[model samples]
Target: MVNCVVKNWQGEAVGETTLDLPVAKEENAAHIVHRALVRQLANARQGTASTKTRAEVRGGGRKPWRQKGTGRARAGSIRSPLWRGGGVIFGPKPRDYSQKMNRKERRLALRTAFNSRIEDLVVVQDFAAELTSPKTKDLVTALARWDVTLEKRVLLITHEPHETLYLSGRNIANLTMILATNLNIHDLLTVSKIVATDAAIAKIQEVYCD
Candidate 1:
């Protein structure tokens, strides 16, 4: 359990909130978080890279020359690995890079990772109602008020999708907006600062706290 100060749109501390999520034990926390990160990165790979082997190369059936050639080295096929324009040797092929971890472990890793970043977390009131229109400048101003540095990577978590909020934040290169329910290891760990709304914090606890 952690106590967090809740700030309004103007960055004033109006109240406090608590976050209580089950995190891994200290000894195994780092290990589990690392596994989760690796799994996510691996699973995102397209695994479309492919290379043909010597046996699969075209026009490999016909021998370039006899096994006992005259005045030249013996050749088996034009597509031989030793020959030019030939198939590759020990080349990579398409494969699944995904890794598997139990659902409980994955969630534990996520909670641990999120919990580890407590110092960088910023709890804010639901500010979607503050945005009357989709204006990037106004959003920027509000983020500045919230002490969010415009140059740093910022992850904004909200309870649900707000059209104006999304549109306002979409243009900011340093800002990434996501729903609390959609939180994942990658986004939860990559950002320098996490700015989450009051409702978002509640949603995260409801969905991930077990």
Candidate 2:
């Protein structure tokens, strides 16, 4: 168990909480975290890219010229890949980019990500909308009070989705807010620090520690 100072919306140290690191035989926490992050990022992609092939191109019905007799090269349709403004020869087509890892591997990856963040973890006593609106400015100010700068990518994990908290950090480029239920490997590795609410920590323990 590790004791960490818990801060409030004002960025003041309001209390402290104990967090337990999951015990596992895996020693390469960094590698696990990286794998988890890769998997999550892969899943996020829509993989909707598509391209038209030469056969799909329009205006290729007629041959440009006779197959023979003419001095010109034997020609196919004007929309052939050899012609200008033709369809792609071997372009990418719409497909899924989602990669699947086994449940055990996914869990391991998440555990590794959590371990990586442990070094830079910051706990918040609670997320009270009354104290701060879901504005980037408010989040920035609070982080500043805690001496956490915008230079480092920050992940704000909570037990549940807090509209104010999510809205506040939505505009921030490097700051990401997510609920514990949605926690994935990709977001965990991308962020430099983890700022978790007390409830979130408990939830993580409940899900991963057991």
Candidate 3:
């Protein structure tokens, strides 16, 4: 077990909590993390690119020239690939780029990503933040106090969604909010720093530490 500092919403370090290294100590953590991230990014693609094929391209009703004769390669139709306004050949078509990994692989990948950021992890002592109203400045100030900068891209993981917390961080350019249930390797690898509330940390341990 490795302990990381535990802080409050005000950014003051109150104590420390031990991290379950068994999960973090998984074999080949780095490789698995990379694979998972690649899969996640690939899966996010829209695959909307499309092009007209010979059969779909409008025209081609009649042959431009007879098979034997006026030569010029014996034109078949204006819509033929040989023509200027013809359909594309070997063009990219819409497709699913998503890659799938077994349940064990996915779990290991997530663990690896969390392991990679173990050193940069900050556990908020408060189980949940209490905010009466949406206030971006207050959240921004607290993060600044903790030295979690916007440039590094702070990712806040919570055990459950909080309306106040969500509203406050919505407009922040470099801050993002996600629940522990939806946690994935891609977001983990992209952020420079991670802040998890006490509940979230416990959830991570419960879900990933075998």
lDDT of each: 0.92, 0.77, 0.81
Expressed as tens digits, the lDDT of each residue in 104-194 for candidate 1 is: 9999998999999999999999998899999999989988898889788999999999999999999999999999989899998889999
Alpha-carbon RMSD of each model? 1.1, 2.7, 2.2
lDDT of 3 by residue, 44-139 (tens): 999989988778899898987788856567777788776788988988899999999877788877876787788788788653445778899888
Clashes of 2: 4
Report the lDDT of model 1 for residue 88: 94
In order of lDDT, best first, we have 1, 3, 2
- The TM-scores, one per candidate, come to 0.96, 0.83, 0.89
Model 3: residues >4 Å from true position, as ranges? 24-27, 66-73
Which of the predicted structures, 2 or 3, would earn the higher TM-score when compared with the native?
A: 3
Candidate 2 wrongly placed segments (more than 4 Å): 8-15, 23-31, 129-138
Residue 68, candidate 1: Cα error in Å is 2.9
What is model 1's C-alpha RMSD?
1.1
Per lDDT, the best of the predicted structures is 1
